[model samples]
Target: MSNTEIEDRQFITIAIKNGLVSKEKVDRAYILQRRIYTQAKVHKPICDILIQMGIITEAQKAQLNAARNVLMGKREEPADEVADDALPDINTARELELTISKDGLQAFIHPEHHQVQDVRIEDLRLFLNRRRIKFGVVDDGQIKSYLSQSPLPEKSFLIAVGQEPESPTPPELKFYFDTNPLRIGRVNEDGSIDWKDRGKLPQVNAGDLIAEIIPGNPGKPGKNVTGKTIVPPKLPKIRLKRGKGVDRSEDGHRFVARTGGMPQLIRKNRVQILSTLNIDGDIGLETGHVEFDGHIEVNGIVQAGYRVKGASIRAKELYNAEFEISGDIISLGGIYRAKIQSNGNLRASHIHTSDLTIFGDVVVEKEIFESTIETNGQLVIDNGTIISSKISAKKGIYANDIGTEASKKCDLDVGIDHRLEREVNLLKADIEKNGKLVQLRKADIEKARQRSDYLNTQLGEIAQEQDGYMVKQRDMDAKLSEAEADKDELQIAFYQKTIRELGEKRNEIDAIVEKYLEEDEGILANIPVYERDVAETEGHIEAAEQKIKALEIESEADPGHPEIKISGTIFNGTCVTSPKATLTTREDYTHTSMRETDVEDGVTTKKFRIKTTSL
Candidate 1:
């Protein structure tokens, strides 16, 4: 073969190896060229044939030709020179068009054709001058560059832009305390809901700065492209008015609390502070829902379906009501079917069918029946009996009697902080969920592997079929060439038809092979992704387990040695659990005390055990 023929073959080889074109498409183009030559007695180049078939673009052909020339020790022409030679002659008759936005904020310049002559920087400047664009004009250097470009940009060029006027700042009132009251329960960090944690009221001390007036300024005006001044909107005026329990500073710009109480906004411009809220009668429809930032005192019972919140509370009785107090609570009468949460100590007469979460100590004068109480401090019931109650206390329990013979079982858990125990339970649940997610990810990976294997088998079968078709097509091509040389028209037609049929069959096999290969690749790719997800989920589970272990260690280090002490008869079915041990009474014990003690079971190791003794 000649050097030119070798170069052409090298170009085709390079294009195929670089993934610029497929080998199958190149082969088809060659067949088309051969057919044309056989019928018209005219030969066409492979590159030209490929381009005519829309398989390769002109730029792609140029790139391949350049590479082939470099490899064959021929000098390659510059890319810009080649591009210039390929471009058509410039259109000198077309004029430049200018467009401005109706708002006079933007201006753009357009050319009639891609290759236009006589486009100057002065022409663009004149267009802007005619449009009276006076502000935010684009740099002149950019306009010159746009005019010098070989092929003008298809989109319009931004020549000028205008500035917009700024809006004025309105006067605002800034309060030091919380203005929006929290009326609902709060959700804890561990996704647990605390129904009694209604938002705290805004409180202030005597002489504390409560509010201030912030003055606003008038914004500056702006000039547009047409030299028109744009004025800003007017600022609203605000005045501060002092109400009861509020004092103004000497400058009259700051407001301070005169007394220690809750600061409240009385109308839109008034500030008032309430020191205490007093209810002379029952808190029902007459009092509505009572919420205050200061102390609250109720003379009668809090009726059902009502909620009360205060920093500290004192009530005569609570009946099916809810109370959220940040400080201490004192109830003189019995609490029935009520829910109370207090951050400080609680002293009540009797608690029945109630749910209480107290952060401080609890003292009851009467009996506590069918109740759930969780306290971080000690529970004292010197003269009361606790019946069928579930109590969890971090400190200890001191009661007269627990669990009557006819009453339901009473469960008591002490020593460990209830908050830590709750967190551990939540972590355990998270670990379980993460474990299930890991299993699901593993299952998905297994399914993907199975699919990949099936697709591989299918692709292998398609490869064999494609090979068979190629062999038959080659044989038919040889027969067709022989008949053409012998001038046998009938034999030529038959062999040509046979070759085309074989080529069509090969194409069908190739399509099937491609589809199978794509499916196999997709499955293989996702297997690693699923594996990564499983690994991440497993990591999360491990972290949660480690956290639980740390929390357990902390819980086990209780220094209080909390226990249940009963001074009167303790009947059967009364169970008490400490951090280290648990004790359940099987028979009645009179005047007994229960505590945790370390005991040895015939070995060197010692474990905690609950011991009972008669008082």
Candidate 2:
């Protein structure tokens, strides 16, 4: 990063020593001059010496732009796409122990890159910045020196969060209120967003799961703030406990979000099974049954013929308990006795339930049944068979014996039957797809069509108004023009400007009307002017388009678009779910959509649903 020049006693003295300045050495020297030193430091004689040696080329200047752009994260230029095969062989990166110039601290390579060049710690840190990764730290030379000399040894880095304070701490979590603007409720404050806090609370059954946010970072993207988000089965008057802690994520009270916020906290607005307060003999719990509500703990062996329901319904030593839940069914005892059908997490021990359907993660101790062994979540089979099923998740499936080929996208363990490998490799394909996405002009077409209708009506109203105004102005004009001298102060500026703007609008509207006539008159020309038919009209929609663009340019200093602004980014308590429409009021680049304006300023994020394709 430095640009300094050495006093060139070498160039003159070296030539004196050799009794001549050879072109090759001079060429190399010029390359060093332009690259390493500024023009002022590198004198005219030395610079000319290198250029005269033919070291600098027009091609090198172009290459510098490509090099600088690639470093700055821009698209590569066409010629720069040349393969590295033409370049010199330079792979074998070696580990180099180097001491810092300031502290003389020898920096050791904890994990060496297998390439040829020594990876400077600074370079490694820069590479990590390109990819925003957490859970890593860059300590100064002092820490590195300490680690090198420490008795514990082999420790590359260490970060320690300080202990909790003696005084009570503030809550780091909040539950979102699903209002037009999201109703943010502090987990620790008075919970009255829900009407239940006003005394008329909603009915809560035994199985209903209630939850609140615990300890976690809560930044919502580009915003300069962070807060933990939590939820419950129903949108209750949320009650978040103060400070950082974990509670009630057991039985059916686990912290998780089925959607929104992060995957942290419990499933919002979904039934969760709570813990069992009683485990008795009279409870006829059996296998093949599932619970979405409160805890179920029974003493007897679950009869294979029956099923039970609730949150955390369990049979003590009961193997063969047929437990079925749409989301998660966690069993502490045996299924040897029963088969469990779960759409979510399934945890059981020494059970003989072969049928396991996990739409989520499944960790089991025994053989799985012919339940298609499918899991949209992770699957962990410790002791038994995970037969014929497609496992699909963003994460991996760890197991001992997987009976069949993976039929879908799955991060499977090392061992699998190679015979059906192709079928097992039905991994989800990541395709970056983009087409014309319906013509961009459809927006213009629709806009033009609507404007035509509006303009026609407005023209009629204005015609009457203008005629009346003209009559009144004629009386005034007659009075002024009759007087002749007072005509200059007649204030025609307002009327002139209005007339000019109206004429421009008339041109826009007339062009669209002609386009509609020109396109459709050959076929079904009789279509009504419904204002919506502009997209279907065939004429020079492009001309109408250029006028709109001109207006947009004029709008730059003209108060921009006429839309009222919402203060925050989130709409209706959710960060916009409609992908194309990134409407937000969030200050962090999330612009809240203005319902008042027909088209947003940034872009008409909504797609143009074209009615016709030919033109």
Candidate 3:
């Protein structure tokens, strides 16, 4: 017997192996089939009897038929012929391929054939049975109709469905300011410091929770088409890289600030804490010397002879004290007679000291009187006056008015380069020299032409005189011959003397004409050389002028417009200096921006005009 026939002998065993029917159910169906034959005296297939007795559903029947067809290697009949469902005696089922969605919520089946034939319910059941897919909301008719369209055999149809996995959410970070170690400092709209909430020093106590880290959840597992489990992707751990004065929790999730001072989160991870040493009163013998790495805030005046150093130093009033800060220096009341140096911005109410040097910008609310101030950045006096002070800014200076008529010696300095202006002036001088040389060469050419013309005229006069002398000598010779022939001795002697004298005059005229001709020829020959010289000089002059024009354009293009604006009156004696120029006020100027205009000096370039204008 063929292998198909041999496998078909145990239909119940095949159904059980395909997971469509259990062994116990097959045993019960066999007993019922034997009782039907013995009591009703009628023989019938056990599978048909199991279906009629409601022991097996239509799906199980289809599974048995599909299993038998797979064993016999039978394929579905053509759609134009008899239907597979009508051929109950013969197995008209085909093998099918199964596919599952990514989520495993849907299962699809397709016939394993080049051209799809009509699909029966049995084919779908057998495909699902082999994969051990047990639970799904199956629609057999929809699957059958989908396969009837003669779709490409490799195309999958929705045959079974399953559940999907629920993924987990990641953790997030939360910051706490008031309750935590870091104190929040508020800034007003006018850029004034607010000390209402902040204490003497912004600090965080040790073991204080600075941030909260929420926990993440793991997702539930799902089932795939082959009854296999599907797992969700793993999530990354959430934690900040701790810096000084901060430490991570034991769970490697939460963060704690260990030190006290100003807390700053840098680079999205590191937490830096700076300590603060506050001074409630003035700087004296009681307070002693003060030096800190973080910040210093003095409530009262800073006495003289005290040297203070910190990152940032804030004083209510400073008088004759020396301060060195790497950061900012802010004086709320004023700075009077104090010598201060800072790396960052410096702000004061009124600066009347003679010694203040800052690396950053300096902003004063009131007048800066007789103060020797120097900063690498700008100097800004907001609606304030500047009196007889020597102020220098590497960038520029801006104030209401520099000095009054009484304090006319106030000096203000800005940043310009004098080298560029000097170079431009030198180019202009060279261009002028080249132009003059070109004109001189042209004049030389014209003078050569005039000299040539005069020589030609002299040569013509000499030629005319020589022709007259030759004719006179010839007439004298001819007359002497005639006299000798007539036997006149006295006439012959007179003619001979006249002819000799004419010959000498003609020789002198010929010598003069020859000298004039040589001079005229020389002038004519040198005219072309002189003309070439003039053309070359003209070209050199044009090139030099073009370079000079380019230099002028570069001088105009220089972007050095630094002005000191004053809303009030600027006194005489106030001197403002830029990189390339300096300006001293001659008269009292009112409500004007005192600026310097770039003026190229021939010998020494004056960069600033020291001019003022209302606009």
Backbone clashes in candidate 3 total 11
Candidates' TM-scores? 0.47, 0.27, 0.36
Per-residue lDDT of 1-615 in model 2, one digit per residue for the tens? 222123244333323222234556765776666665574563444534444556433343233334434534674662654432211111111122222222111123333332323434444443222222122233657434543442323333332111211332333443432211111111224411231121111122332323544443232222110111222122222233311122245532243333221111122223332333355553353233444343354655456556665433334444544565544444445455455555445555543425454444555555444343444334555334444333332233444444423322112221122212222232111010111212434554455566656656666665676566556555654454444444544455554455566566656656665665555443232224422343343323444345445444432322211111222221221121111222322222222222222244456645521111110
Candidate 1 lDDT over 232-297, as tens digits, reads 777766667887789998877799999888776532356777677888989999989999876687
Ranking by lDDT: 1, 3, 2
* Higher-ranked by lDDT: 1 or 3: 1
lDDT of each: 0.76, 0.37, 0.67
Candidate 1 lDDT trough over 10 residues, lowest sum: 85-94
Give the C-alpha miss distance for residue 572 in model 2, angstroms. Answer: 55
Candidate 2 wrongly placed segments (more than 4 Å): 1-293, 300-311, 316-345, 349-361, 375-382, 386-445, 448-615
- Predicted candidate 3 versus true structure: per-residue lDDT over 1-615, tens digit per residue: 645335435566665554556767777777886798799977677678668867666655664565466555775333343333322222222345656776677877666676756655574454455465555746666756675676445756666777667786777767654322111223468844343433333457777777767877767877666566777666545546666677788887777878766654432344555577788998877887788877677888788778888777777778877888866677776888888877666777788855887766687777898789887667877467888788877657777767766654787776542334455577667767767876776777688888878887777777787777777877887898899998798998899889888878877877777787788788888888877876876777677678767556544543344667766777876677775567677777877876666543444444336656784
Stretches of candidate 1 exceeding 4 Å from the true structure = 1-283, 286-301, 307-316, 322-333, 340-347, 357-360, 403-413, 416-423, 453-468, 471-475, 521-532, 557-562, 567-591, 600-609
Instruction: Return the clash pairs for model 1, or none.
Output: none
* Candidate of highest TM-score: 1
lDDT of 2 at 38: 78
Candidate 2's clash total is 55
Error of 1 at 453 (Å): 5.0
